[model samples]
Target: MLVSRGQQSTLLNRVKIEGRGLHTGAPVAVTVNPAPPDSGFVFSRTDLPGKPSLKACPERVSETSRSTTLEDANCRIGTVEHFLAAAAVAELDNLYIEVQGPEMPIMDGSSQPIFSELEKGGRKKQEAPRLWRKIEEPVFVREGFASLVVLPEERFRVTFVFIGPPPIGHQVVDRERDWEELLPARTFGWLEEARELREKGLARGGGEDCALIFSSGEAAPPYRLPDEPVSHKVLDLLGDLALYRPILGHFIAVRSGHSLNNKMARKLKEGEAGSNARKMFADN
Candidate 1:
């Protein structure tokens, strides 16, 4: 089991990254800076007028096709799962992310670069206690064959079962202490779907360097891990869960993606709110 930290933390210094969006293929720059306690994770669209900002929360998730996207009345941000996953693992409670484009840079199509940058910037504990949430009862969400469930646990854990065609038939990953292994696993896709996805205005920026592409029911040599695709699924799940406060539970996902993950997060947050309301009424 993982131990919880008593105090909140933020980056000690600012860090910047520049790359191309995996879907938009547009060049972008991102700067992550430390923020005051309780600030949570906030994103600002620096390229747009007024520099509109939005907090990272489950309710703000507006899109989840090929990636998780957040939007508000004034602005929208796409492909944020990688960065958010890194922050969750780094235990960063407060951060101000400034993006100079509509989508986040898909650096190497993995969370390793982002996680490394955050570590290089260092971390410092803040005065306030860390915001941790736990469920007293199981929270579950499902859609057809995909499902996600969170059960009460003393520490955070994730178990993912990936189901796909051909090259990515079926794979399972159970992660608890070895988060570093998941960071290096890059996003993947079938080579056969490249043209179709591009025609739909997606994966325009994707390339062999940024993603693992399989052809003729076979992936190229040099796999990052035994089952890299499944590991990436685990990474994406953690990022989606980050929308709510840090949770203490064992999350089990089967054929789940961003949409299902976000639904589970909203349910978990709603359950916590209801529990708090009951406690407040009893005290009154």
Candidate 2:
């Protein structure tokens, strides 16, 4: 896909979508409205009084379990990665997302739905040049068997590895495919984990329809694409990175999830700060 160059962008019109939340099981109505350039992606809780808003940034990430959640003083937005991933791929720089519930609708457990909506809504370029974080050095994080590594690159790219139990073993995907190629890859969970999550008041609205359920000894549902699970992980990483400015780097993630992904974002943010500081001192 051709990356949007030079100017920043936002939706040209307001787009609305309604569906059931993955965890809340309650219906939600979301309106994606255009905002002035440089505003970044922000969320507003319309169901609550005062309509509190929260910026979608790595610093505001409050939860990174099976999904990513953001929080402000008293407002929270859950399961936001899929939506943010779509926005990133669309090269959107500013948006005001108003939600009528605590979480976004599962929307087939992939980013394709969100991308389609944004495509129909259209995009408009702004006056300011789009900002980007270009990694000049390698940065990495490791925990147990998982790891995330960022290397300097001219464009954003990702390589992800997913390792699951039987019926789904180790899978590796290396590519710079466009969002359209990866957007339909659905979030997946082991059958046991899915049941436990539901018992803990999560994934209440999830079923075989929205998410892929894997079993220890049974077959996985027909895949939308080869290595769909790992592709979805790549999608999640893209969404997490979208929390900050677009990155010009290559990411290598192995057995990683949202927690590690968010940690990488924090590290990258710190790296940017440090780089700016060094440049300032050198100029003096």
Candidate 3:
């Protein structure tokens, strides 16, 4: 259950899961397979001809409306943040995830199921040392009311704050000792937004079990903890950023969604590139 320092790891066995996609509502089956060291997380379209694969990297992201989507000429996969977050928390550095449909299964709109599956698979260290991004300076991005800030640290940490109208008013969640609290936090939205997404042919699988609905006079879904909405946002943020190597820093996020999370990830990558360039110049 412990990842050795300076060692890479992957699942010891393969695990399969089946559920419905949050956006497409199509029933899908996914299998998590162990990959060689340094492979990173990859998604393969098993149902498609030739089984095209896409690397789960932030630069591969093509869309982030409602959910994060990865796209390439051969395939596109949507709603991947929850699954990715589970992988990140598990310290799974390499994996081959095969999916039978266009989107990842919602799994009650929480990361719990995916994390459980990974736990069942266990973990085994590889020969290579683990890779990670070490932050050297503060990197920050802001878009009006939403912002993400990353400051240098020796380990990963996150804090999230959210503000919304009515029932969802002002929630903040601090990172706990482990990621367990974040796993059960389900995706949520306003009743009006749900109706609009349904009209646009989205959120087809969302319901009382898969998501929390905030509407006057309507019963809310069972909250796993207080301020679960903000917890879920943090879940999404962690997932989106998991595309990069494990990052060493403290991330402070405010009202950020999938789009903003991905933007922060890109900025992190850019920062690394800049750091490398400066190092090379000094060496020369």
Candidate 4:
């Protein structure tokens, strides 16, 4: 018989932040605390009567608009990928996130706050061996004008293509996981999207200070990479990985969003059934 030794870790302490939800425009506060072994990542809405905690998983997904919303029928939580991404890349296997609102704080329209808080909280190795979902076959899904596919790989890889009206023209990014370089890419919105979102009472407070707002016939702000949209798309994908599955495969995304992300996550769940590879994961 063969056995594999792997590393698993979680945070040593808790981290907290306060801000407003990007779309809901609701003021909220969040605290990420360490959990017992195998707790994974769970969200507790303290604002609700019972402080219902919604665990991050595909099963909890109730909607996928501009952001991902997870609900348990009794309660709902929104816009959580960035913080989840921070925990994923840091390799935290367990966390307890208690929020005092319906959605998480936008926190600079990026995962910056999550990153900073994770670093300050520090990471500690656990006694348990890492449990990973080793991919054996291709799993995929499609949305309007977009698609997502994941194929077997030794490590995580994200491939995305950004295309639309000019300046926001066709762009592609494919890279193996590098959390440090990828984590800082901020979320963005076009003028048409911004205005419409506001008209609909969403993200009315989102501005240049928080997100990268791109308008027609105008140049983009100082960017770290030529195709930063695709990079940020990768960030979004990583955040969604908090579904607590190690997708040992490459994900190819084209004009995708939370909808496609949730779709692909569901498909991946089905494929993992009866996989020959060693699968280690917590209940998400």
Q: Give the C-alpha miss distance for residue 174 in model 2, angstroms.
A: 1.3
Candidate 2 yields a Cα-based lDDT of 0.88
The C-alpha lDDT values of all candidates are 0.88, 0.88, 0.87, 0.77
**Candidate 4 residues 1-284, lDDT tens each?**
01234666777888888898887777788888888766778889888888888678877888887777889877788888888877887778788889998888888777767888888889988777767776667777897888888787787777888786766688888888566677777888787888887888888558777777788899877765566666777778888766846666788888988888888877666555546434343222
> Where does candidate 4 stray beyond 4 Å?
1-5, 276-284
Per-residue lDDT, model 2, residue 111, is: 94
Between candidates 2 and 4, the one scoring higher on lDDT is 2
Per-residue CA lDDT of candidate 2, range 104-208, in tens?
889899999989999899999899878788777899998889999989888778888888777878999888756679999999988888899888997889988
lDDT of model 2, residue 251:
92
lDDT measured at residue 268 in model 3 versus the true structure, 0 to 100: 78
**What's model 4's lDDT at 228?**
68
Candidate number with the higher TM-score (3 or 4) = 3
So what's the TM-score on candidate 2? Answer: 0.95
- TM-score of every candidate: 0.94, 0.95, 0.93, 0.91
lDDT of 3 by residue, 36-105 (tens): 9889999999999999999988898999888999999998999999999999888889999999999999
What C-alpha lDDT, on a 0 to 100 scale, does residue 63 get in candidate 3?
97
Superposed model 1: Cα runs more than 4 Å off: 1-5, 219-221, 278-284
Clash pairs, candidate 2, are none
| Model 1 CA lDDT for position 213 | 81
